[model samples]
Target: MSEISREILSVGDLNRAIASSLEERFDAVWVSGEISNFKAYDSGHWYFSLKDEEGQIRCVMFRGRNGQVGFVPQSGDLVEVGASLGLYVPRGDIQLTIQTLRRAGMGGLYEAFLKLKARLAKEGLFDLERKREIPAHPRSIGIITSLQAAALKDVLSTLARRAPHIPIVIYPTLVQGPEAPSGIVAALKSAAKENAVDVILLVRGGGSIEDLWAFNDEQLAYAIAQSPIPIVSGVGHETDTTIADFVADLRAPTPTGAAELAAPRRDQMLQELAAIEQALSQRIHQRVEREAQTLDQFALRLSHALPNPERMREQIQHWQQRLKQAWLVRVDSWSRNQSHYAQQLEMLNPQRTLERGYAVVLNAKTGLQAVRNPDELNTHSAFEIRLADGVANVKFAELESRKS
Candidate 1:
C-alpha cells in the first residue's frame, strides 16, 4: 500500500539543525574534566579537549572571556567549566563554548569567599567613609610580608627606585599556610603599637585561591580595618581579590604597586615643587607689576595737580617786561615836565624882561626904594632910573601933578 513520503536533509541543513537543537535543548552546564591538547593562539583564544575516563569533548574559550580565569590552564590540569553545549556547523562536531573555568575542587573555596565578602560588606568594613586617606608624602613606610617571599623583594626594589629618601620598615611574617592569618595580625598589631609609620603595605605574590586563602581570613580583614596607619593591600595579581583588599584603605594590583602607592616618587615631587615655585613667582611678579602701574598713575595725576615751573617762569618774565615799560614811561614823563618847568621859569626871569627893553626906577637918597608917583618925590629932590645896562639920576623941575 504504499511508499511513504520521506524528508531528506542536506549536509549543511543537518549540521545547522543539530547545532540549533543542542543550543536550544541545553542551558549553561558545569562539567568536570582534565584538560588535554590545550593550545593557546596568538589571537588569545584557547582550544582544548576535556576528558574523563570514558568520554571527551572539545572546548573553546575566547580572549574576551578567558582573561577572567586569573590563571593560565595547562594540559592535564583538572578543571571545571561552565559552558553551553553547541555543534560546530562547519565540522558537524559537538563542542563546548566555555564561559568560566576554575580548578576543579575550588568550588567550595570560591563559595566561602563570596559568603565572607558579602558578610563583611554588610558589616560596613568596606565602607568608604571609614577608610583613611593615604598620605601623599609618608614619613616612613612599613611592609608586612614574609622575608623569604618574592613579593617582598619586588616591593623593596620598587620603593628604592621611586623614593630612596623614605625609610622602610619590614615586618616579616608568614604569608601562607594555616598560621599565616595570625602572623599577619600580630605584625599589624606590632606596627600599630609602634606608631612609627605613616602607611603600611600588605603584599603577596600571585597564586591560586588555595595559596592566597590566608589573605581572605576574617581576622586579617579586621586587622586591616582597625589599623592605626593606613594600609595598602597588594595580594596576588591584578585579577585576584581578597578580603584584605576590600578592608584596606587602598588596594594595589601587585606588590610593586603597593610600594608605589605608599611612597611618592622623588622625581615627580620635585617636578611638582618646581611648578609651584614658578606659579608663586608669577603671582608675585603680577602683584608687583600692578603696584608699579598704580604708582605710575598716581605720579601722572600729581603732575597734573601741580603747576608747571616753565609756565610760571614765563608769566614772571611777562610781568617783568610790563614793569620795565611802565618805569620807562614814568621817567620820560618826568623829563618832559622838567623841561616845561624850566621854560616857564626862564620866561618869568627879570633878566629876560630887562633883555626885552624894560627899566627899573628907585629913590636916589634911598637907592633901595623905587619912586612910583610924583607926589612922593620932593620938588627939588633927585631921583634915579635903572635900566638893563645902566642907572641915571634926575631932579624935579616943576611942581605940577597929573590927576588920574
Candidate 2:
C-alpha cells in the first residue's frame, strides 16, 4: 500500500452528509406513477412503491408530513408523488420519502372517481341530511347480492335467527367477476321495481381490495345513493370500507350484522308485546273495578231510597184532582169570553145584515156602485142588485138624476 488517506466519519456525520446532499440536489422532485405496495402503519407512517409500466421506486410517507395531504394513497392507484431522495441510514438504501401524493393519469377511472366523489359531496349527496333512517320493524326485507355467495348465507342465517317471521325477497345477482357491477345494478333496479320491501340489504363477504372492487364502482355507488328504498351496506369485514358504505343509508360491519340491524329482534318484540298486554290488562282491570264500585254505589243508593208505591199513588191522585179543578175553571172563563165575542161579531156581520132583508146594488160595466145621477151612468152598461143569497143583473134602461 502506498499512502493511505484516513478520514474519520461517524454514522451521524455520514447520514448528515448524505441527507444534506440529497436536500440540496433532489429536495423537490415530482415523480408520476401508479401507487403500489401501499401500507399505512399504525404509527401514522406510510410505506409504498410508485411504479410505472416498466419500473418502480420504493417510497415512504411519514405521518407528520403526509397527514397534511388531501387524498389518501392506495395500492394500484396512479398518483403524482412529491418527495426527497434520501438514504435510509441503517440500510444505506436510497428511497423516495413522499411529502405529497396526488392521483396520476389526469383522464382515468381514478380521476373520475375523485371528480364524482367531489361533485356528489358538493351536492350534499354524502350529507347526513340526505341519509334515511333504517326501519325498526321491516315487514319485508329485500336482499341484493350474489345468489351463491357466503355473504348471502350469512345474511339469511342471521335473518332467520333474528327475525324469522319477516318476509324476505332475495334479488340475487353476481357480486364479483367482470359482470358483477352490471349485475348488481340490475338487481337493485329489479328490487326497486317490486316495491314490496321496507328496507334493502346490499351485502357481500369480506375480501381483498380487488375482490371488493365491484362495490367501489362509480355506477354502483350512484345506484345505491339513488335507491328508492333505504339500503344497508355490509360489503366487507369491519376493517374494509368502500364507496357503497358511504352512499348507503346505513353501513354494517358484516353480513350478519346487516341482517341484525335491518330488523328488530323477535324476543325483544315479544317482550314489548308482553309488556303492552300486561299494561292493557292492568288498565282494564282497574277500569272494571272502578265501574263495579260505581255500580255498587248506585245499587246501595237505589236500595236506600226505594219509593213507597201506595204513597206515590196517593200523590198522583192528588195532582189529578188539582189538574181537573184547574181545567174546569179555564173552561168556564173560555166559555164566557166566547159568548161575549160572539155577540160583538153578530153585530158587525155583513151577511147577517143582508139576511135581515138589506140589499146592495152595483153597476156591471165599470163594476162600480149604481148611481142615481144621469151623467154618472152609461146606457150601454149593466148593473147588479144583491140581496141576502141572490143577485140580479140589470141594464140601465133610463138615466135618473138626483140633485144633492
Candidate 3:
C-alpha cells in the first residue's frame, strides 16, 4: 500500500478543516426544539442550547444584524432555530450558530415577545420611577391609536362630556401585528416632535394579549418611558396589564377612563365655582348686617346720651356763643394793638410833621437838606421845598437863612 501522505495542518488549516466538516456533514437548515440553558452576555451576545425530549444540541444566537430577534428568546421556550452546524476549533465540539429563531408551536413571535420584555425590563424601561406624571390640566391631549377603533369614539365622547374645550390631537397607528410596535413608536415620536400636546393618550380597545402585543414591545415601552411629555396608557380591559401600562405615567382601564383622568368635568367645576360664589355672598351679607347693627347701636347710644332734642340744640347754641365771644375778643385786641402802633408810627413820620405846617428845604444839585445858616446854603442854586401837598422846585437867587 502507498504510504498515506502525512497531512500537517496549521492552526488556521485545522479551524478551516473543522469548519468545512461542520458545513458539509450538517447542512444549514432549520430545527425546532425547546430552549435550554439560555445565557446572555454583557457584550450583547447570546448562547443557548436547544433540545428535544431525548437529545440536545448547543446553539448560539450572535449579536449580528438580527440581534433584535434575540431580545425575545428565553429558556424553556419552544423555538425553531435557523442555523449552520459548526465545530469549535479548540474543543472540536459541534454546535449550531443560530441565525434566527421562531416559536416552535406558536411561531417565533411569541418568543420575540418574551425576549423583548426581558430586555426592556433589564434596561429599567418599566421602572415606575422613570415614569412622568400626567398634567392635571393638559391643554391639548394627543391620542395614538387607530381612528376606527372603538376606543377612539369612547375617548371622544368622554372628553366632550368632561372637558369639551380641551383640544384633541389624533395620530393614527396600528395596534396589532408585527409592524404594530414600530408604528406605535413612530406615532409617539411624531407626537413628541410636534409637541402640540401636553399629555399623550396611548389607547386601544379591549383585546387579547396577542392583539395588544405591540404595546408590550420593548421599544414601545422604552419610547413611552423616554417621552418628554407624560403618557396615559389605556390599552385593553381593566384586567389587562401591558408593558406600556407599566411604563406609562398613568394607566387607565379604558380610553374613556383616560379621558376622564386627563381633564376635570366642566359641569363639576362650574358647580364648585357657583358654591364658592354663594359662600362669598353669604359672608359678605353677614358682614354687612353686622356692620349695620354696629352703626345702629352707635346712633342709639348717641341719642340716649342727649335724651331731649331741645337740650342738645341748647348745648350746641351755647358752644357757638362761646366760640363767637372768644373770636371777637381776639379780633378786638388785634385791632387795638394795630391802632396804637399806627399812631406811634405816625408820630415818627417827617411827612406827618410836614403836614402839621412844617416845610423841608433841600438843595437841588447837592440833594441835601437846607440848613438855617446862610453859610450852609448855596446861593444861585436850584432848591426843592417839600410841602405837605406838593413839592416846589425853585432857584435860590439869594441865601436867606434865619437863626432860630
Candidate 4:
C-alpha cells in the first residue's frame, strides 16, 4: 500500500478561508440582474437570487442595510445591487451581502420622463388649475385597462367593500405594447362620448418603466387632457410616477386608492350625517337659550321703566322733601361761612392792630416811610408816629450810633 500525504482541513476553517479571500478580492462590487426567489422574513431581512441570462447568485440584504432601498423589489424586476461577496459560514454557501439596491434601466426612462414632463408642462397640460376635481360621489365609474389585469380585482374589491351601490364600467383595452397608446385613446373617447360615468380611472399594477411606457404616450396625454369627464391616473406603485399622472384630474398611488377616490364609504357618510345633525341640534338649543335670556332681560327692563300712579306720587313727595332739606342745609352752610369770614376781616383791621399795642411810624418828609434800621434816623430829623386815631410829630434830641 502507498500512503498519500494530504492537507486535512475542517469545514469551518475552509469556509472562513474562502470568505476572507472573497472579501479581499471582491470588496465593493456591483452586480446587475433580474430578481428572483425573493422572500422577506419577519426579521426585516430580504433573501433573493440575482440572475442574468447566463447564471445566478444567491443574495441577502440584511435588515440594517435593506431599509435604504427606496422601492420594494418584485420578482422579475431588473435591479442592480452593490454588495460584497461572502460565504454563509453555517451552510458554506456562496452568496452576496447586498449594501445597496435600485431599479436597473431607470436612468434612461427617467430622462425620457423628465423630457416629456417638461414638454407637457410647457404646453400647460399639467396645469393644476385645469385639473378637474374628482366628484365626491360619482354615479358611475369607468375603468380603462386589460380585462385580465390583476388591478381590476383590487379595484372591484375595494369599491364593493366601500360603496357597493356605485356602478363599475370596465372598458377592455390593450394596456401594453405599441398598440396600447391607440387603444387607450379610443377608450378615453368612448368613455367621454358615452357620458354615462361621472369619472374615469386608468389603473394598472406596478411594472418596469418600459412596460409602463404606453401610458407615457404624447397623444394619450392630449386625449386625457381633452376629456370632459375627470380622470384619475393610478398606474404603477406609489413610487412610480408616469406622464399620465401629471395630465389626469387626480393621481392615486394604487388601483384600490383610485376606487376609494371614486366613491364615498356608506358608513363614513352616515357618521358625517349624524355629526351634522348633532351640531345643528346643539346650535338650535343654544339659540333658544340666548333668546330666553334676552326675553328675561327685556322683561326686567320693562318692569323698571313701567310707571305706577301711587309710586310716582311717592317719588314726587320724596323729592320735594329732599329738596327742602337740601335748601336748609345750604342756607346754614352759607351763614357759617359768612361768620367765619367776618371774624377774619375784623382781625385784619388796623384799629384792632393799634388796640393790640402795635404802632405805625412815618418820616415827616415821606409819609409812612419804611425804616428798616435805626440808622435811618439822625439828629434833628423830624418824624411822625401814628397812634390809633392820631398822628404826632417828634424830633430826636441826640444823634448816636450804637455800632458805628
Residue 225 CA displacement from its true place in model 4, Å: 0.8
Looking at model 3, report the run of 10 residues with the lowest lDDT sum.
364-373
Q: lDDT by residue for model 1 over 1-404, one digit each (tens)?
A: 23433767889999999999889999899999888888899999999999888999999999999999998886666799999999998898899999999987434567689899999999999999999999998888989998788998899889879986676777879999999999999999999998878999999999867789999999889989989899999999999899999999999999999998888887887677567656755665576568556655655665566588566556555755675566567656755765676576456445576678986556655422445566777767777866777778877777777857
TM-score of each predicted structure versus truth = 0.55, 0.49, 0.45, 0.55
Off by over 4 Å in 1: 1-106, 306-404
Candidate 4, residue 220: the lDDT equals: 96
lDDT of each: 0.84, 0.77, 0.76, 0.81
Best by lDDT: 1
- Candidate 4 C-alpha error for residue 50, in Å: 14
Pick the winner on lDDT between candidates 2 and 4: 4
Among all windows of ten consecutive residues in candidate 4, which has the lowest summed lDDT? 364-373
Considering lDDT, which of the candidate structures 3 and 4 is the better prediction for this target?
4
In angstroms, what RMSD does candidate 2 have relative to the true structure?
A: 37.2
TM-score winner between 1 and 3, please give it. 1
Residue pairs of candidate 4 with colliding backbone atoms: none
- When 1 and 4 are scored with lDDT, the better candidate is 1
Location of the lowest summed lDDT over 10 successive residues in candidate 1:
363-372
**In each prediction, how many residue pairs overlap at the backbone (N, C-alpha, C within less than 3 A)?**
0, 1, 4, 0
- Write down the TM-score for model 2: 0.49
